[model samples]
Target chain A: MRAAAQVFDEYGLAGSSISKIMTRAGTTQGAMYFHFKSKENLARAVINEQAADLSLPERPEGLAQLIGLTFFLAREMQSNVLFRAGVTLAVEQGQVGLRDFSPYDMWADLFRGELEAARSKGELQDDVDVAEVAQLLVAAYTGSQVMSNLLTGPDRADLPERIGRMWRYVLPGIAQPDRLAELREVAERTGPAA
Target chain B: MRAAAQVFDEYGLAGSSISKIMTRAGTTQGAMYFHFKSKENLARAVINEQAADLSLPERPEGLAQLIGLTFFLAREMQSNVLFRAGVTLAVEQGQVGLRDFSPYDMWADLFRGELEAARSKGELQDDVDVAEVAQLLVAAYTGSQVMSNLLTGPDRADLPERIGRMWRYVLPGIAQPDRLAELREVAERTGPAA
Candidate 1:
């Protein structure tokens, strides 16, 4: 799976091949087939197992926890090849056959959980739309990492910092007026996992 | 150029070939080489000319103009083959050779222009960081479009609406407290070019 992810990450779905993946993994055809049946199946397995290994930090403030989750994901993207590969596949899935699952939808579902908690705790403003904000954040983070990686490579110095700034731009509209400043500060304090 | 852009948009840089481009363009090798020396050179030309044909609307409010430009771009991505191809090349440049010109950088520069104008006009908050905001917006929009394309292709219904919501969330932080309400209304007014 790691080898397949690397090949998919470097070359998109159309460019990737089973021969390249097998060569990278250093495994025989029979051995590979015994584990995974086809390239599409392997790609789907990679997408499904993207978040299987990591743990998320728990912050008392739900909004802060949400920010921390993204910060952590950004850090993981820099270091974890499997995570990076899943992201690359999810973004370019339109050009490939693996359209059954969307990483964006999963991320948004996770965000909605935190956002609802923040709202119940009175951290969010009355009119803040949770679903819309979740969608925007998911998209923003997705695009930011792609652009950051494209411009500066995976282990970028500014990926976490950029996400921090993204929360700064978003919190004012979502956070309660009294807690806006505090939330912005907390967002900054989520710090660079770099 | 349009043919090349279409091929690149469908298949990324690594997957695209000169033969496919020429066949799509319905041109002979002599005609093609007479204009572009190599595939890389032609790709670079497409990248540089990505925004050359776009003419952003001249709204009186600079912030509104910025929103208008993005909304315009979202709509164009659905209909304009060249634009979509350029965006694909810019995002996936890491997988290929055309790394010199970044679409994100060009977008940030354009956003900075509008942001500077808004700041000078006192429409923005005193502490608003124009460059950082520019970067965030560029990333946010890039990711949003990729997701939109993935989910519903370029002509998606909710893309412009999503972008509208993005500015609504962001403007509260960037706009002066006095103009926040007015700016939100203007943001909604920007609408989708569709």
Candidate 2:
């Protein structure tokens, strides 16, 4: 999966080949095929197992958790080839003959859970729809990483800073008025690169 | 340029070749090479000339102009191959030998101009930094397009809607308190698919 993700990330779908993945993995065709069946199948496995390396910090639940999760993702995307590969594959899936929105959907669902908890804790404004905010966060984070990746390529050192900047612009619209100051504080303290 | 953008958009940078672009353009390799020198040069030209097709609407200045421009971009990316190609090439620059952040920087500069105008007109909150907000918009828009392109593929039918959704979550934080209601109204009326 890691090798497939790396190949897919580096070359995109149409440019990647089974031989390249095998060489990257240092495995024989028969052995690789035995596990993944085909190139597309290997790609699928990579996409499906993308989140295996992600682990959010043991922070308090609610908005802080969401903030920490975003920061963690930015950091991971910088250092973790598998995570970055999964994102690249998920974004470029159409070129690879795969129809999948599950990656974004799964992320939205995860954000929703965190937002729902925040709502229950009165961290979110009454009018702020958890699902909508979740989608917004996913979209913003996804785009930020893509831009950072494009600008800096493999280093990805600027990703955390970009995402940290994102939360600053977005969090104000969703957090409760009274809780706004604290939430902004949380965002700043946990901000990208911090 | 059109042919190169289309090929790049469909296959990404690594997957694209001079012959493919020439075939798409209905031109000969010698003719293409005479002008472009190499595939990388052609790709660079495509990235550099991306904004040629773009024309912002003659609308009122300030935040409304910014909003309209975002909507306009979504519409263009849906219909304009050159614009899409430029964006694709810029985002996937890692595959090509060229290193360019000019595309994004240009976008940020454009957004900053509108934001500066908005601030001058008192449409923005005093606490807002035009540069920071501009970067945020560029990042959010970049991310939104990637996700929309991912979920909907080349059709990109849902792009305007996704961007509209993004505005809903982002604008309140930047608009002046007195102008918030009007900004929200404009967002809904100009919203994607609306």
Candidate 3:
């Protein structure tokens, strides 16, 4: 999967060949074919795996952990060269083919659940449209990273700071200030990087 | 230029060969090459032409026009297949080769100029970070259109409504309430679709 992702990222999906991926995997064609029937199937598996890597489980106990995870994922997304390669493949796809948007649906569902928990706990504005807010935030966060990719290219120097600012602006609007203060305190106490 | 744009729109940049564009324009290679050296040059020319079409003048009078233009462009971007062609080319180029981002820079400059005018005219907040606001709005507007392009493949049924709602929400915070009310009246009078 990593080998395929690397090839797919270096050259776009259309440009990458199955033979090239097989060679990179250091495996025979039979082995590769046994795993994934076609080139597209292999590509789909790479995408599904990358999505799984980023996906987090249900967390009702800690909003801070949720925020920290998003921050970590963003950092990893910008730093990990393999992930960047996967991103290139995804961008090349550009929503051109593949009918299954189940990953997006799943992430959205998970995100909505998180926001709903916050609302139920009285940690957000009573009037806050949780779903809309969650949707907009997701859009802004993901879309901004794409922007970062375009502007910064392979050297994503400004990503961390930009994401830092995003969280600062976004968390203030959504988080209950007192609870957020405690979370910040915890993060600070944990470490400098945290 | 329009012919070239049409060619690119109907068939993607790579697909729309120079010969095809020349055929569309009813001109020979010599004439086309006299103005543009290659297909890339022609694509640059078409992009430049779009920039010229969107020139807001060194001095623009209408505050509402500035905001309206953005809203209008966002909707146009979503609905028009031709618009997607440009986005696709730009994004694709960014991933592989360095895209001719000069056109985007030109548009950003024009957008910033209008924002400065609005600020000086006391239409926008004096403390408003015009650079941030301009880029933020452009990024969100462009980014959302990209998302819609991905999700819906340019059918664009809810695009105007979505952008309109986003505009209504953000514009109020930036624009004076009286100005917003005035614009609201004008919008109602025109009875334009969202």
lDDT of 2 by residue, B1-194 (tens): 88888888777666688999999999997899889877788788888888888886444378988888899888888888888888866765555546688888888988899898898899988888888788778888877887777778776888898788788878878998799889878877776756
What DockQ would candidate 1 receive versus the native complex? 0.55
Q: Which portions of model 2 miss their true places by more than 4 Å?
A: A6-17, A56-60, B9-16, B57-60
* Strongest candidate by DockQ: 1
Could you tell which candidate, 1 or 2, scores higher by lDDT?
Answer: 2
Worst 10 residues of 2 chain A by lDDT: A52-61
Q: Worst lDDT window (10 residues) for model 1 chain B?
A: B92-101
Interface C-alpha RMSD after superposing true interface residues, each candidate, one decimal: 2.6, 2.5, 4.0
Q: What local lDDT score does residue B146 receive in model 1, on the 0 to 100 scale?
A: 78
Candidate scoring better on DockQ of 1 and 2: 1
Q: What is the DockQ for all candidates, taken in turn?
A: 0.55, 0.49, 0.26
Cα deviation in Å at residue B99, candidate 3? Answer: 3.5
Candidate 2 has a TM-score of: 0.91
lDDT of 1 by residue, A1-194 (tens): 98998888777666688888999999999999999888787788778778866786543347878878888888888878788788876765544445543677888888988999998899998988888999999988988887777678666557898898898788888899998878777777776633
Which scores greater on DockQ, model 1 or model 3? 1
The lDDT leader among the candidates is: 2
**Candidate 1 local distance difference test against the native:** 0.79
Q: Name the 10 consecutive residues with the lowest summed lDDT in model 3 chain A.
A: A183-192
lDDT of each: 0.79, 0.81, 0.59
Task: Write the residue-wise lDDT of candidate 3 on B121-190 in tens digits.
Answer: 7777554566555555554555455555556655545555445544544454466555777765554333
